[model samples]
Target: MDLYRNIPRKDKLLSLFNDDYAKTILNYAIDQELSNLRKLIADNKIHKIDEQLLIKNIDKRYNELISGSLKRVVNATGIVLHTNLGRAPLSEDFIHNIKDIVSRYSNLEYDLEKGVRGERYHHVVEYLKIITNCEDALVVNNNAAAVFLINNTFNKGKKVIISRGELVEIGGSFRIPEVIANSGAILKEVGTTNKTKISDYENAIDEDTTMIIKIHKSNYAIIGFTDEVPYREIPKIAQKFGLLSYCDLGSGSIIPGIGCNEPTLSEIYNYGYDLVSCSGDKLFGSVQAGIIIGKKKLIEKLKKNQLLRMLRVDKITLSLLQETLKAYLTDSYNNIRSVNLLGTPLTDLLKKAKKLKRILNRHLSDYFDFETKEITSYTGGGSCPMHEIKSYAVICKSKKIDINKIENFLRKYHIPVIIRLVDNKIVLDVRTIFEDEFVLIKDALVWATNQLS
Candidate 1:
């Protein structure tokens, strides 16, 4: 069979892609496509190959190779702090403010006032101290790194006590016990899964005990008939035993009046713990960082640890976090995108939903019926598992087209519009959708209708 001959040469395929795509990538794409075609031929999966169709496939492969996987997508799912879609959305203003620092050279580690070498963490530490009112603060790559660094630094080769109920498994199968054990610390589980009293922690302490860690169950809740020692008590017990007390407030809340059950950073600070750690991306509404704020002496010890060099954040993270803290210091919560989205009033969301419904009706009415419906949103990213945010969504139903088809089309659009399905109807929550995205949403819906027709 001339099926193999029908497959064009790599050089021939390269000529088809005359765009700005890299030559190496184009060649790699051609090789991959040719290899797949050969395998199909050997397996008898393909009987014949059309030369023109082969060119088209090769062109498609080249474009796919050059186009990166990370893309900007519209979040219509109503989950504000969506972990999969890049945890927290940084404010445009924050990004704009840091453009100069990231794009050009600046005193990232140099102190201009002293005209000498300085520390990178200092840039944000002052801001954090001002906002959090902690004696000292440190920022790591992520919250997990912060926890591991703390454990490795303070409790290495020693026993660390934590309640069995508080041994949480965060996203991506990262468990608390595993992190502790891997950090050269022995994890001592205390009390039952549903209840752990202050006495449990005290009893667990022995000659090997070095610290008591209080892990916040940020992702899930164990409700009803539960008895747990107050967080403030853990610090007291540790002090009596001459041990360190640290709290991992997984999704650390810095902003007040957000209406979540999680305690704020200030309240946690006043809990008398030697150190406190929380995620910068979660309720903090900043970039992905591990924030450790505590006694100056303890923080100084963490800074001296060799692991600090590895887990330290880059200048970009420091700048972004600095701007976010500045927003907090100025009491401009609205400037933070995540906080703004979380604080959006129900009536405002309803108005936006109604406006979207009318827009969809005017354009897609012939194919689908559009109406506004009340729905519940979430502060996703493993924070406030039991809290439900009342929101509004635009529900679409079609008599001719399949709901799944519309969803698939919108998801694959150039600017993907992520949506949810409720009662077999396509729903788009306006809480997470921005006003500037309205045009994009309408265009995606219209494109979906065209494809379905």
Candidate 2:
């Protein structure tokens, strides 16, 4: 103590041990440093570490170990198909299929009939082409990859015509111009941001133009005094120039009702687009995938691209997606979770609201004012931005707690009840909630009431 007392704080701390203890501490510290250093090296981000910052670096590693890893959380934010919450939840049928294939090595690349090696894409290709009535089809990891493959294979170093209005930036700060740039294709902007005429596309066409690309504004819409060239018109323009007509229907929906603006895959195929690309997990309600369908020649070219191999779907994605496609093929539409949620009637929603009210009343009648009222639920997941389906919900009245606090409390409950703060009370919309989720709703309410007490 006397030997260390006169030393400065920094030097004393670094030298608080004898030679043997110092060697052991330094070795352990070196091991810890090397553990982190190895990770940086693996990530190709390695750099020189400062010895002076060793203590601060150690603190970061200790903090990471204690942090919660990815775990299931209740979606009480009212954003169904919330991107952060893994987008769309897989249907039971799809989940079972995935488990079965993953548990045992099924015929992932082996053909049962031919008794030989088969392509993995054969699983979903026929179904996708049949469902969309396209000449050929392909699947990739995501819609972005689909676009990249299509552009890179077909229009690399060539001009791609697009409307300025439809060049939208969806979630994740991803922009259309950026994707075009990344594909090594020249983006020939046709018209103004809100208005683009067919003539603008016609004038933009030249010897350098290889394709006419139409992008759907999945997340936003321009209403009132907006003018844009219809998708059908572009196919003719492409035909005139002997170029391909490609529509990147970002959020493709097959089951259409209740005011959805998404154009179906069949609709685009019928109208005469040579190629169509869309996301599987958005309106189609499948696992994350990119489904591209089009002319046989063009699709064959895309399949031959070297990049296609890199962006190909895995065994799990193909297995689950095959089951999801079967669900669509069957007449039973309720098997699809997103479709069922979209098609749920107000009367059905009201019944759920009443049941929820009864459950809440059993726990705490004094805490809330319960009433079934008309409400609107959006077809989220960027399918229909302007459309809101009319629904019913149970509005809770709370005098002691503010609407935000009630919502926060319900959200933090074990089952996590997503409630809307309506007219200063926590409102429960039954449209998005599943009929089977009643038990969860009851438990969440019970938990919330206990919190208040």
Candidate 3:
């Protein structure tokens, strides 16, 4: 008690916040840290934290304040589109191309030929047209922004009929009805959660009806006795009534079978949708952006919307999305991390699991048990929740470390290995684990188990 009472004043503690840390964090961080140290002394179990220990603790606090809030971690969890690990990994080409854009000032809004103000979306529009076969294209900050802009543009103060089954909220609690309502659009949900027919949509239509929306349930699935109108059918009925039809292809799949198995943009456009929107990051394997493809007149209308200016994608997003589309046009999509990973064969995944198991055995034979187990890897990022890629994983059972400790040990590495605890065992799925990252996993295992060995 005397030791804790004799502790330095709060001002003395605040003084320890040096130039290494931001000015804002100095006082609060120092007070919190010193308060903890004092509590330890008050408890008397920690003995007495000497002046040297206090100084050292404050330095640690400084490091914590300055450290980046985000970390680069290895995805051993088998969720390829792991949302937390920054979703899709960029291809080497995108990275290489982005260097020049990041390093130098770009003609982001400058027309080189016209010597005048140009649209930033021009960088990606031509490629989007080529790939999607749409009359025109537009991009915005995110899919929500795209949806908000679309609904707000045409359907505000008007009725937009949508299926009850398709009223989905993605990862961030961004709900369809909420977005529609916020855009000042009236949402007229028809039919039941499991069955919504084209007739139901047709019945909802009147003078107030401006657009019919089909939201593809990307993140979840409701199986058994579920019947809903096809995306083509809704748009067909909309066209009959002279109403606009839009499809929110949530996964934004470009490749037919690669991601989520959602219909491609070309398929949607060719099916006669007036407007279709999708995500650039989810299935496109690029940075986060929303791509809208449809009739030229509709896109031009979107461009003219005042909301377009507020929701426009920046130069970096344009450059990355443009390069990603180019890769698709050139048939170099296999070079993309997400595409290649999703396209990996089950046989290849099994081989990777076995190889990783063998490597772990060789390095950590004494302290752990390494075995290959049959597992199913998820096509994550709210793309295809029901669709799974059956694969194999390496399960590690440590002789000394508990299951949670094993995970913590991996996290202690310079590049942490994020694993999954399945059936009371730690699993490392090699589906997203490329050939190069294997060695790092091995090294992490060795370092983590060194004490036990």
lDDT of each: 0.89, 0.77, 0.85
In terms of TM-score, which candidate is strongest? Answer: 1
Better of 2 and 3 by TM-score: 3
lDDT of 3 by residue, 1-453 (tens): 467666778677666556656767666666776788767866766866587777677666666667755777889888878888888989877878889997799999999999999888889889988887899999999888999999999999999999899899887788999999999999999999988877898888889999999887978887888889987797789879999999988778888988556788789889999999988888778889999999999999999999888898888888888788888888996767898888888898889998888888887877778899888878898788778788788988877777777778888787888899976678999988877888899998887777444
The deviation in Å at residue 27 for candidate 1 is 0.8
lDDT of 1 by residue, 1-453 (tens): 768887777777777777687888778877887898899999999898867777777778877776776899999999999998998899989988999999999898898999999999888889878877899999999999999999999999999999999999988999999999999999999999999998898888999999999998978888898999888898999999999999999888887667377888878888898999999998999999999999999999999999999999998999999999999889888888898899999999999998888887888888888888898878999888889989999988886888899899998899899999988898899999998898899999999989989
Model 3: colliding residue pairs: none
Error of 1 at 116 (Å): 1.4
Better of 1 and 2 by lDDT: 1
User: Would you list the clashing residue pairs of candidate 2?
Assistant: 76-418, 369-397
How many Å off is the CA of 152 in candidate 2? 1.1
- Model 2 Cα lDDT, one tens digit per residue, 398-438: 75655676677776664556566756877677766666676
After superposing candidate 3 on the true structure, give the runs of residues whose Cα lies further than 4 Å from its correct spot.
2-5, 9-32, 35-54, 450-453
Ranking by lDDT: 1, 3, 2
